[model samples]
Target: MQPTHRSRRILRPVRIWFVYLSLCVALLLSYVPTGQVPGVPDWVALLLAFWCVRERQHVGMGAGFIFGVLVDIGYGAAMGQHALAYVLLAYAANAVSRRVLWFTPLQQSIQILPLLLGAQLVMVVVRMLAGAEFPGWGYFLSSVTGTLLWLPLHFVLLLPQYQPEERDNNRPI
Candidate 1:
């Protein structure tokens, strides 16, 4: 007989302040100009999706909109481009949060690729409508990069919430 293993860890409740703080950090990271860099992930959108999935109640469309707008202002892109993209990303993430949580981080990243792509697609379409030329295929690489970062980012973000590994004899988990 094979010994059964626990696939999931019980996590402490996430602090609301930490969530916003991490988002702010991501916002700051995005402000750094990586000139001509291909496959540089959209840090704000990536972190927003992570929070949307992990803490759906605390982070959702409203947070998405605010950060998206900030990203727009920082990038000097057309207003509402990233905002619409992020709002849609949040909704999609929320809708799939439960299902995505059932999988490992690698699997979750695969599942989330579409959501990331959809968000990018929204921005592309909005930009085109605003008379901007197509940004070319390389623009989509950010979504792929974000997907690749998902596994590590998952462990890092959840590290604080992981319960102590030592088993206590007095208390039943």
Candidate 2:
């Protein structure tokens, strides 16, 4: 049976709430220190990048900025550090999402490498500017590990497929 417009509107909010809940869970998980999990990536960044790719409209730059601020507050870090990183990362993910149909899950995962790395680099630069000591190369490992986990995470999350129209026309007809 076809639902009325009112029902559709109601369901929209429910879907949004689910997304918000998932993000909150991801945030909480990020704070859980991994004990001897030698190579676990930054769960929050991985989740955020996935959200940026999958739900660009809902998880836009402003949302990223706000989330980053929250992270900074929670972790007791310099203000605007995570905010800048999150917003920049969100923008990068969204920009490339427009051309995403050409990429497989593996390719998309590979693409995340640069975004993650670039975001970390920005964070490092910001921290340096704020007179924070260097955390060393290990700090950047989170981005690398995050990128590697993207494909599996995407599959696990069951994100929506890219629309056919979004596919690039520059390739074979």
- Number of the predicted model whose TM-score against the real structure is largest: 1
Show pairs that collide, candidate 2: none
Show where candidate 2 strays beyond 4 Å: 1-14, 34-38, 159-173
| Tens-digit lDDT track of model 1 for 108-128 | 999989999999999999999
Measured by TM-score, how close is model 2 to the native structure?
0.77
lDDT of 2: 0.75
What lDDT tens digits, residue by residue, belong to model 2 across residues 65-164? 8788888887777898888998999999899886763567787888889988888898899999999888777788888788788878876665332223
Q: State the lDDT at 80 in candidate 2.
A: 89
